[model samples]
Target: MNSTQQWQNVTWFEVDEHQDGQRIDNFLFSRLKGVPKSRIYRLIREGQVRVNKKRIKAETKLAIGDQIRVAPIRYEIKEETDAPVSDKVAQSLLSRIVYEDEGLMVVNKPSGIAVHGGSCVAYGLIEGLRAASGKKYLELIHRIDRDTSGLVMISKKRSTLKLLQDLLREHKIKKTYVAVVKGQVSLDKQLINAPLLRYELANGERRVCVSKDGKESKTQWNVQERFMHGTLVHASPLSGRTHQIRVHGLSIGHPLIGDDKYGHETTYKGPKPRRLCLHAMRLEIPGYAPIEAPMPEDMQSLVAQLRAQKADKVVVSDKDDE
Candidate 1:
């Protein structure tokens, strides 16, 4: 129980002996009597519900003697598909676009914006995209980590969604990324082969982490530039796995510079780039000519600062060599 919770409403439910091992969200969904499932999932996403007095995942299990506190939620019944999202928000979402055509659109998503709204997001990227284009069938073809900035694919038609999904399955499209990490990496290039599994903590959210139990993932990277404070690298993934780049970067001891959730810390020794220093720099489709997008100005400035620092170190080393 939070020391500062002045709950506007509270519902207490006792765990039955039969439901003792069921996931908290599942248990609540079955026993809450009248609340909508959408609202229940949203409550889990928004940190409103508590199990044993600790905020937890929808998948968390209810144990015996656990005190479940359902917080004060204004449960408004609305279609999950028709939640209110406006066109202007979709137009604003245009700033993230990397490439677009009739069949597919690729967006350079920001670090924190979700591609699709789930129970907690309320309004998702597609909701805005739907309002912006006024297209009824717009859909996301693939997934990206919520905290990673990069190329996201969207389909204009349901048939197109299947086509594009097939392309991804066949590895028909190629995506490239650039990431700044905390190291002086010396290797020109290497391949990282690892597997990932969704890891859930006792009371926190779930995240993808490397494990023997995970699915196969592969990544190739080359050190574009190295600095005393870190290394900037170009990344190419052969397989699209959740958090593959971020996890591989961290595994190699060079977590993305500002990825606090995965990278551990944000501040650097030199100039600071405010967001996660990762960018979807290029995309190549099997049939079309390659499309390249340069790093956003914010990330470019940080790279310049790192190179300048590297030059200063080089000058000092050269003078010593002389």
Candidate 2:
């Protein structure tokens, strides 16, 4: 392998402080521009990509001074596959970045943008960020639904990713969400414990339901405000399952407003909301200052409307008492 202008056929990377805590797969994505993420995973699986002379998984975080072996392959930046991001989308992603440091990036991901590309999505938030920043090891530590908007953590260091993932599994990191549901919540506080199972229907659509044979799931919520049409509540899922909060909210008979899957469209009163009225409001990491994402404009408007109605009721009660 020649040490020339072009990359070597098989290159060795010595992880420096900047590279430490970055996942090997993400590192490769940075180095091998134009390569698809799926291909990168395949390389790791086939042992073409290795660390310390042994095959490593894509999620393997590099340590300082670790040596990585990157196998060479025919590479070309295809126009169709490497379609350029529009300036509008690029700027949107750039402006949404809330916090960024050596080890992590927190973004207020917009609703309707998938976290990563797939499911007929040509490119999503992560891809947009990668193109905008040109960083090699940018990776999502957790995911929020495409219809859900809020703080999303992108790990820059492999160590941080591992640590945060561990905390999530143990339910140590606190995540709070605010949502508007279809009916008035009678309980100020309630805990819903149920078992959830996911299934795919004949049409290949996926859904989750509470079943006796499913994994345990729990959601704790308190009514923030009651409305004639619906309820605004603060909800936290104690267990992480796919759609855990959404499913649990549905099980308790207060499906989130704009929940096309588990909620009845006709049940919601007034003008229909433009999007799902759910937002990832805040995140409390064990060692960092709590991060909060302001409610997006659409959801904020709906909540404000509900509040005004509640205040009107109060005024009417006062008049009657007088």
Candidate 3:
């Protein structure tokens, strides 16, 4: 199959086993390079893109042997370029591999590096890994925000992708994160059950908010330590939704300490954190041993500062009258 062919005329794709269960929109995005997502959605909505000769939604999953037809659409050929991945970026990603097997590998993804290429980013962790390792089937099993450093799983085979994704959907895979939130949580353990809805701003930035009409979401938080102005907690999301933990923390008036979005930055008087204080510290799969990533140096420094502040306060309070 000529996956890079420009859709100057009608194009047909027969789904193979490798392509099975992939979303129709994603499939189109790969084939119809340089096309905007809005254009692709419009094509699907207007019935210009069809499966088995019938109109289908963007979320439609493709099955083996299914036929996809795309109507004629002229797109700029020059807009797409084969840019080489940077050696620095590729080596950085390869060195962070914490776990690897015949099926998949886990990477301790650093903050500011995206999982995949999109938006304005030319290439991300996955792209760099693919380029460096020469692996064709590497795919993200789950995603963490670009600013949130954590352990991310990448599948080397399609079957492993399906299995791990199914485990994530069923909540069988446990993911634990450590975060420093703005307020000292009174409760030792708490569960925030709030639904989240994703919306786009007028400027086209995507954001998530807690809305009653949104999808059900839950996050379990346990206070690990308390400071004078902040608290270190372990956050485990019971449901996967866009910005689930960040939004849920905001809903409870304890947003993450360094969250630019959904955070109370002005109210924080402590030293400014370098990045988002959330880290995917631990992951537990049913059949496999737990995978963990140590807290980054910056985060560790922030926690230490908080501890010092708490100690100073205790010393001041315990002093006798002057």
Candidate 4:
């Protein structure tokens, strides 16, 4: 116990066809009795959930015989805490890993899984990573929304974390995203330059809104494809602001198809999508060139289907979000 790295045993799990398309948290709860849904969520955010050595979406459809890697969190706590039932927690948590390394780890978070905890849950992705890695501490370099999925950047060392954070602040890091917008976009590309006002509630929950008196924000958007029914858009923000893409899309009158926070039109009508259609498609870090991750098949298929519908305007651009 002199070193920070400790190892604990975790049981592997199998997913039956009956639970084929269930969200990751739900599956974990059903299989891992006694584990709180919130704790399972924290584990998924921590990069502890893995499937066949790769990070995956919490709600990622499980194929038959999918193997998962799970480890219990062992903390040198200031106070005694209840230990969870062992095998049950392990079974649900081990199925969604895409990749991991000492330098960084990438996780495919589900649409409903928040990257961190807040008013609803006490622990978040950062807390979970510390437990899962059994390290003194692990840090997140960046985060996707609770409902956004795709690659997330994590750092094992504070120095590495600082380097990445600096790069992001200076606009050296580039994040690429794939999304479905509600309307057709005429422009091939456009930019949104808006300001954002961020508010942290009393309970530490945060929300962003557009205010003329807010901080500057910018978003560049391109039309990847336009469908008959809607447009598929690719978005990249010059600045990282909470719900930047979602709010900007709304400001331009074409909200992201499934984002309830920003899609006022769609939300009023009904749930157009089962999950938010935002994906952290790619990221460019400080390196020889850049690292790019492709969009998940589900989103790709969604765009392809929309194209078949012959969308008139398919993408949009908004400057900022709170």
Candidate 5:
């Protein structure tokens, strides 16, 4: 297979067993090196790419023996000036790996770093790992938001990726997140069942809201600790919708602290948070022991401050009674 720049004639590919079940867009990404993702998507949308002699969507899955046609398109060849991953960044990513095996790896991702690169991000965790470890097949099994940090799984083999994704779709894998919300929670445990709709604004910013005409979403929230102003809670999302925990927490009037998107300004003004107070604490997968990431130092410090403030208020109230 020739690279995109070298292609002058139309090309045909037969999907073999290894290539079966992969999305058309992803297949194009792998084969058409140096081709921008936007260009590939445009080609698919313009009917320039076809499968089985018919136009197909980008997400269309390929089957064994499927014939794919790639029409020739010219793109300006640009210099490959992508910077090499620095040693410091590479070591930082290496030290965050909690578990690793031949098939998969569980990384305790840090906040403010994206799981994979796209859009304006030049390189993300997966790209850094690939450069550092020289692993060509490493791919993200799931994604956590850039501002939210915690356990992210990377599959080393395509078979493992397929298996884990199937498990996720069947609701067999369990994911637990810890977050600190704006207000105190009275309930010991609560089930948030709401339908969520995802839409884009005129400025192209994506947002999710609870609406009747939406997909069913559920999150099991349990209070872990209480403060006078904030509540630290464990959130287990039953459905993997975008921003499930954040939207559910907002629906219940306790948006996550430091969540600029869904949270409102609160009257409690003890300590300001630096980032979104959400973390993927634990993940439970069948046939494997639970994988856990300890609370980050920033969150721990915030929780301790809240606890101290609560203690001070208790002492003041007692003094007043006396």
Candidate 6:
């Protein structure tokens, strides 16, 4: 629980022209810095947040000249530091920027770091980048799960953000991931065309599963290496959906190594990977040079082990045939 100071008061905000078409929830999040998203949703649900004196849903769009009322709430406020993020996280994120120009930035996002601050995360990648860049229009172009490390795009201009979003929706942006799975990928090349549905568990955790009534999703995968215990595969998602790559990787009976959400505890028999062995290795935008991220150290170590063991197995097979 937050130890909030009581101020039985309300604050009113007038929507500006530039803020038009923004979701009420997002607008509130931008205004109420350091407040948890759950609390914002609660405020809307309890009729504490009103637009033009009428209760509105979280997804309601804001228009110019509309009045927003926010009831007094308890929240924790932290003092601003020199850096927008902690020193350790800030340094890590700064070092990972692969490409940046006047209107765009690309980063090799590390595993276990959220792209945006939400849920239990206090300050995320975007927040750190914004604090470092001192830019007024920086925003995310797309999102990936916290556990999945890979190429992430950040737009420094609103026009660039809109253009990149349109490209992603049209499947024009080419993104590729390198993943190590528990079993040998049966096909050299395979395409998974499954529909996925997002659902919340009883404990409120979000999860995605394949269902007949879900939205169409497709992923193309090609084997990079076949190991005795696992395989290194390159995966490309044709349709952008939450957990599309992870779930589609599971459909072929080769669940990703260290993927706790969809793979079993006993999934891998080789050296255990430190985290999910998935990396966004490559990204191609229409008007930009292709950006590639090298394999992280942890994944490299695991791959070396797989390669050594695979070599030994091949030698043993040769002797047995003789």
Best by TM-score: 3
lDDT of each: 0.70, 0.78, 0.82, 0.64, 0.82, 0.80
lDDT (0-100) at residue 70 of candidate 5?
A: 88
Over 4 Å off, model 5? 1-79, 266-268, 311-322
Candidate 3 or 5, higher TM-score?
3
TM for every model, in the order presented, reads 0.69, 0.74, 0.85, 0.64, 0.81, 0.80
C-alpha lDDT of candidate 5 relative to the true structure: 0.82
Best-to-worst TM-score order: 3, 5, 6, 2, 1, 4
Q: Which stretches of candidate 2 lie over 4 Å from their true place?
A: 1-82, 310-322
Clashing pairs for predicted structure model 5, backbone only: none
Task: For candidate 4, write residues 1-322 as lDDT tens digits.
Answer: 1223333468588765443333455456434434444556567767788877788755454555677776675432221133222443333223344556666665555566555543343345544555555566355567788888777776665456556667877899888898888766667778888898875555445568789988899999887776655667889999988789988888787788767666655532322466778888777776725555576666666666665553353244443322
lDDT per residue as tens, model 3, 1-322:
1124354878899999877766687677656655655567778879999999999987687889999999989664433345467777678788999999999899999999877654455567777898989998787778899999989998888788778878888999999999999867777778888899987666556689999899999899888888887889999999988789999888988999889988755388777899999999999997899999999999999999988884323222232111
Q: Which is the winner by TM-score between candidate 2 and candidate 5?
A: 5
- What does candidate 1's lDDT look like per residue over 1-322, in tens digits? 1122132468877765544445565466434424545567668877778877778986575666788888775543444345555555666688667678887787777677766654345555766677777776566777676666677777765456556666777888888899888766556677878888865555445568889999888888877787878888998888877678888888777788877668666345867768888877777777777877777777888888888874423221212110
Instruction: Kindly indicate the candidate among 4 and 5 with the higher lDDT.
Output: 5
Q: Worst lDDT window (10 residues) for model 1?
A: 313-322
Candidate 2: pairs in clash: 21-157, 21-158, 22-158
Which 10 consecutive residues of model 3 have the lowest summed lDDT? 313-322
Better of 2 and 6 by TM-score: 6
lDDT, model 4, position 195: 99
Can you give the lDDT of residue 75 in candidate 6? 61
Q: How many backbone clashes can be found in candidate 3?
A: 0
Candidate 6, residue 70: how far the Cα is off, in Å: 8.2
Question: For candidate 4, what is the TM-score?
Answer: 0.64
